[model samples]
Target: MEVRRRDPCQSVQNFSSSSAPYHTIFVFLIPLLVGVIEINNVQNRSKSLIETHLMSMCLFLLAILIYAFAYFAAMKSELQVFKAIEMISGSLCSVSLVSIILPRPYGHFSFIIWAFVLLLVAYKESFHMKIWQFWNRFGGNNQQLLPTKCVVGCPAYP
Candidate 1:
């Protein structure tokens, strides 16, 4: 297989039982939330809300990147799979941003789109169980159907 890392995880502890959500949020999400709050604070102070919001959005993108990087480092995941997932998710998200939930970045080009995709991948990995994990657990592919090469009574084809 053309891959770099192993499956999801040997144990669920890898995702959920880190015992320190505070640390995770502190190191990653808090700065992001704070930057947003700062933009609000700026708006409250009668400064340019648009400019602050833009800057806050940029900061949020940075925070997402930071969190994705941290998740990659901590999770011992395959970079190849992560890259593929990020690319596909980014494309799909852009489509949704364009077609349905049109966000600002969809209207305008922004790295925020990619950063959102990275966040999505990171958040998904936090679930611990993977597609392969579920499939294997459920014995999903036990039966196989083969096409018959012969219509009536060809021994070799049958």
Candidate 2:
């Protein structure tokens, strides 16, 4: 029989309920709240049950994928995950902005989108300090994550 050795750099470890970070509550609450709101909006605004169900399923899948990615990244303690999360959050913000700015009759979806986008932004920004520290500690200061020469003097979001 072979005994497995644990990696010293492993970031995730099993912990008792009491030992877990309280901040993880946001992980559960944000998804649950957004799901309920998305379902309610789809039900109220969609023209038919089929459309509502379809949209809800799509939203559910997207939300699940996003949450899964975030959870895994957090567990694995990967700093690169933030870039993907930021891209998705920015896209969601753009969608919400469009929904708010456009003169359309998408009242229900508008609020739902806005809420989800805000939640995502808040969640990501909550770790801004940690992310910055990680980058600096890992020798990422001199390396550029994105090309910025296209726009002179302007800071790139990526």
Candidate 3:
């Protein structure tokens, strides 16, 4: 009688390839459906600015939770890239959420400013450029792209 053992690397490769499709649907499609439902609910309701901001923050938290779950559940080495993207997304969400503490005008303006910063970061990452290089290419001088202190310094509404 002869005994044989399966190759460990082969088993891992097979598992990852087989599970990729299921992970794709779980990590991508489910969150997309959640987003659609959230948008629909928001549109159908008459919420105040604070309520809307809270809802937005909740959504971002939900997304981060989903991605975190996916990151842990994923077996493929390639799926690790989600971690970096997830962190960036969280930072962008936090930036917008910070505006909720400020007065109405400043809060709204801060949201716009942070959204632009998010765009800049996305552009820089997509083009594989350093942040300073991105600023240089886009004609920004000395990296003072926007007055971010306004968000921190603005007084809260009474």
Candidate 4:
């Protein structure tokens, strides 16, 4: 008997089934990894600060773009919800990028802006409400931590 290959959709299903845990880990790790890579690139003298930063920004943006497309293709039915998350995350990333791209006075605030962007990135990809809930625990319903429409397609929402 010949062995058969597993269906690709099955793998996608498995990956999407418990995306929160992975998203939580990835959200915390990607920025650290990007920082490390940027430091190493600078130390190696492989690229100037501007070059490395631009490269890093492009890579991060590409990652977001790829994930959005793949997620849409995989889920195939949550277009509206995905669009909302995309808008939120994309806007945050754009603001952070702008802060860094502009001249000194504004660039000085890049780190703070980028930090928020990273958090929003995590929220968009993971839809991990626990992170949001953790921050909002002092008051308000955790149920309302994110807009209902923003989480409509999220596995964690239900």
Candidate 5:
């Protein structure tokens, strides 16, 4: 009698591919549910927008990371990349939740900055680009583009 041994990697690949659809559905449904709950509970409509935006951004990033991870797993390559994506997604989700809970940080400016940093980190990791390269591309390498004076002048500035 011959016993066949199933390869663990093969099982994981199968599971990841097979579960992709469910993951997609779960990702899409989460924002809708959270938005409804937040809308009802939040007294200030303006503040709710910031919380919803951060949550949606985190979910969007997670969806992209999961899609990329599943694609690579199916191809049987980039296991290390999968791990990196997993870590970033976990951290991004945690930060987003924390920002929501502490909603008054610098009048939500800090949350926006935090979300931007998470995005920048994810972009840097995925594409192996330096932070300066990204800023130069989008920010045009202008020293005065952000204008520290305005940030410092804001009432919320500490």
Candidate 6:
């Protein structure tokens, strides 16, 4: 059966109202907070090593955050988490690529790694997803590989 799509606004409203995976949220956000805080020190006598480390950590944290949000949002909402992962992966890949292409930086590898993680998240979500073919376009019947064929050959072939 074809599922009706819910309004985006309503979906977000419902997600926020429900309880999500708190531990998952905390794990990523805390690192992000710390990394952003560390970046603040760059204002005075900024060193390349410090900048590079902070940038890499922040990029990793942001990637983790994206995956966490999708994973948790799925816990409360009826929305397909795979779709969210796919969208996020595509976005992350683009961002990572742009960062690598323009203005060479020491943290180029870090951005690329984020893109890789996004891909892994997408793959994991897809593999775990139980696609209800019966409730989907499959009409709840056994999926046919090719149109029905005779054991040997069809009458028309003979």
Can you write out model 3's per-residue Cα lDDT over 123-151, one digit (the tens) per residue? 67654346335544554342253332334
Per-model lDDT: 0.43, 0.46, 0.51, 0.51, 0.50, 0.48
lDDT of 6 by residue, 1-158 (tens): 99976544455444433322333334445555455544654575556433645554454447556755765665566675543663463345344433433355633765666668667855775642333322234432222432344343544333
lDDT of 1 at 11: 34
Per-candidate total of colliding backbone pairs: 0, 0, 0, 0, 0, 1
* Worst 10 contiguous positions by lDDT, candidate 6: 133-142
For every candidate, C-alpha RMSD to the true structure in Å: 15.8, 15.1, 19.4, 14.3, 20.0, 16.4
Ranking by TM-score: 3, 2, 5, 6, 4, 1
Error of 2 at 127 (Å): 8.9
Q: 1-158, model 4: which lDDT tens digit per residue?
A: 99986554454444433233434444565565556555555646855655646644664577567556644543554344554454444444444444434565765476566677667765675555664455446433333533334344555434
Which residue pairs come into collision in candidate 3? none
Off by over 4 Å in 2: 7-9, 12-26, 30-53, 82-127, 130-158
lDDT of 5 at 22: 30
Worst 10 residues of 5 by lDDT: 143-152
The local lDDT score (0 to 100) that residue 52 gets in candidate 5 is: 60
Candidate 2 per-residue lDDT over residues 1-158, each given as its tens digit: 99976532232232111112222343444555555555656746736433534443454457456655654555555454543563454344334333433345773476577677657756887675564566556644432553424344455421
After the best TM-score superposition of candidate 4, give how far the Cα of residue 35 lies from its true spot, in angstroms: 26
Query: lDDT at 118 for candidate 5?
Result: 67
Ten-residue stretch with the least lDDT total in model 2: 14-23
The regions of model 1 sitting more than 4 angstroms off are 1-9, 16-24, 27-50, 53-57, 77-158
C-alpha-based local distance difference test score of model 6 = 0.48
Candidate 3 lDDT at 42 equals: 76
What C-alpha lDDT does candidate 1 achieve relative to the native structure?
0.43
Ten-residue segment with the worst summed lDDT in candidate 1?
A: 93-102
